[model samples]
Target: MSKQRPNLYYTELDLFILLSKIGLRRKLKPSERRVLVKVYYSEYATPVVPVLITNGKIRLCGDYKLTLNNNLIVDEHSLSTSEELFNGLAEGDKFTKIDLRNAYLNWKVRDEDQHLLTFNTHKGHYNSTRLMFDLNGPPAKWQRKIENILKGIPGVYYL
Candidate 1:
């Protein structure tokens, strides 16, 4: 007999803890809730998929194919730009990377404004009650949330 593969799942409790870190509970609508679930499932299903949410933006994890269409998510110039940014940062004398606790969840999403960042998944499409970044498109409104988080942090850079 063939062994069955593990059906990894994100329990409601697991999602609760994750969403709580971002303070996003009670904010997601039915559709948005469904979408977030789908993301977790898809990512888990494909270990090769890149998973990154850095600087409150979804940083390029790997070359991804947009589920909206089969279009490749990377362009040559963008990859080069990403490489340059990494190379420049690597040359820095000192580096301190700070990752917030559930960064995106820290911001609140109003009921009326949840539809703007909506996205669809193979399971279904849903809007985010919280913010999501589009590295290729204009910054989302939650950019301010990151700004505020950074402001509260004390830092000094001298040339």
Candidate 2:
């Protein structure tokens, strides 16, 4: 049989614990609960996927496909084609590459929308405060955000 590859994700800790302190749990305070959106009932929460250890750190994520991916209205931001990428460029154009580390974490989910990102684990319930990679719309959302910010800047292109 082939290996059972899970989209692998989860671990839990006390509310707002640092990455160094995973696997610990504590009850959320009222104010902290305001921001975290704790799922009191597992019925409303999606199961956390699987867990992996990378660079001696724990990485937790969810399989949103089993939950939010289908129902969500995907952002319809179309991508540029190869021809479009080259359209504004000239011969011998110097190129530079810039990558934003932890780029998804830069965008916060709207206050009303955070609960849509919530997931449940054996340990507890939780939600993302910022955009996560597994969500269906972030690529388009991020692309649109970048495009909006870079609109008037000259000589800049994104794929």
- Could you tell me every candidate's TM-score relative to the true structure? 0.29, 0.64
Give the per-residue lDDT of model 2 (tens digit) for 14-91. Answer: 323542256424455675455456556433355454455677644556667766676677889887887887886654
lDDT of 2: 0.62
Q: Show where candidate 1 strays beyond 4 Å.
A: 1-97, 100-105, 135-159
What local distance difference test score does each model get? 0.36, 0.62
Off by over 4 Å in 2: 1-39, 51-58, 100-102
**Residues 3-102 of candidate 1: C-alpha lDDT, one tens digit per residue:** 3332222224543354445434345567555434333212212111223365673221111123221321333221225565465566567676655433
Candidate 1 lDDT score at position 107 = 49
- Per-candidate alpha-carbon RMSD to the true structure: 13.5, 8.1
Q: Tell me the TM-score of model 2.
A: 0.64
